[model samples]
Target: MKRRSLLKLGLGGAVLLGLVGGGMALLKPGLVDKHMSPSARELMRAVALSVMDGLWPAPGAARDAALQAHLDRVDANIGGYPAAVRAELSQLFALLSSSGGRLALIGMSQDWPKASVAEIQELLNELRLSSLDLRQQIYHALRDLNTIAFFTAPEHWASTGYPGPREIP
Candidate 1:
């Protein structure tokens, strides 16, 4: 096939995939206007485990509670965003929730819950350094959200060596 034909084929395939992904998101409006859905929570948990690796306590009840708390904070933070931003996030969550989106976008063939922290970290690094603007943007959004949620809690400040804000004179 001619180079031009191949380019067109690739572009057409991307568009088709985008359309299918959008349709799937619309079909499942979990994260659209509401609080974090189960899938979204799971996605964020996986991301948090990867991004906040050493920050988390050892694998036990405390770690589990901390993870849950982080998710709650993330949900709260997302809730405060404007509707348009929330809608965009909803679409992003929906896309990642789908297997095709996970593979095509993040190169992760497994479901979020099943994916290991190392796998997630590798995908996140790839996203961070990817040539594609969309992938990089996704990485930033996920990283920013997780970091913001984890850091904003006063209880976590000690871990970061950020003594609570100095008292007013």
Candidate 2:
């Protein structure tokens, strides 16, 4: 083929490759997993610890692992919701993750992970008592999701006086 035709073909191939690469990148999950964004996941970690304070394992590897398990369950539960609901949750999580949002909503200037249990409890209490309906809803949603995930485990059932499902003989 002539030099011009060869050059044209090469450029076309490059363009096609670029387009395909960009498409794949867009489709890839990036920072957000199937159900939660990175910030959202981070926020949930702190929230879980706070909401399950007395119930949470003592600070150690076991506690870390338990927190992750609960977060995974929470993620799975969030995945079951419709797209719109998921989007709203994502937005809420992201907002809470930000410094400004944390201060405004939770009244905490420190990072979520660093915030003490008392601080978190206070923020949650404030949220629950807030005159704003949205704040109250946010508090309930976070508390309920964490509780549901924590109690879903069989071990937690014992604490609640719930025996494992009984099979009919």
Candidate 3:
């Protein structure tokens, strides 16, 4: 009787372990795990990092100009993003502008090599805050894509087949 009871207890424990392991497998990221390939995840990370790179402090005009050039290249390649994503990007862009303004203001207070230490420090602080704020905005935008159902349906408009954008005339 004692041996039978012990065997039953061991079996129950194994079953419980199996159930928990299966549950954890199911709990893991479903869509991201199955849908987003490695390349896609890397691309998303690159986009976020590009935004972060823009917010970094640039001391010299040459470095600043180079950063601007890189940004233009990325802009041309990325093209027009979706409307919802664009709105969030715009918010981050505004923060970048604010950081740039601080840099210019601090530049004004001191000479090329020797500037107001306090203003420079303040500019760095502002840039850090701006970067953090932008990170949050980007996260919110990506997280939203997981849940928001943007398109409920679809339609097609063609010439002669339906009333298209061109007009009847």
**Per-candidate clashes, comma-separated:** 0, 0, 0
- For candidate 2, list the clashing residue pairs, or say none: none
Off by over 4 Å in 1: 30-32
Which should have the higher lDDT, number 2 or number 3? 2
Residue 163 error, candidate 3, Å: 52
Q: How many backbone collisions does model 3 have?
A: 0
Q: TM-score per candidate, in order?
A: 0.94, 0.76, 0.23
Model 3 residue pairs with clashes: none
The ten-residue window of minimal lDDT in model 1 covers: 28-37
Locate the minimum summed-lDDT window of 10 residues in model 3. 147-156
Ranking by lDDT: 1, 2, 3
Tens digit of per-residue lDDT, candidate 1, span 46-74: 99999999999999999999999899899
Per residue, candidate 3 scores C-alpha lDDT tens digits across 1-169 of 6999999998997677456434433343112212332333332333333334443346587655544444343343334456554443433333222323213322233322242435434444454455466434434543333112111111212212555356567
lDDT of candidate 2 over 75-125, digit per residue (tens)? 998888787777667656655666655565567788877878888888899
Candidate lDDT scores, in order, read 0.89, 0.76, 0.38
Output the lDDT of residue 44, model 1.
Answer: 93
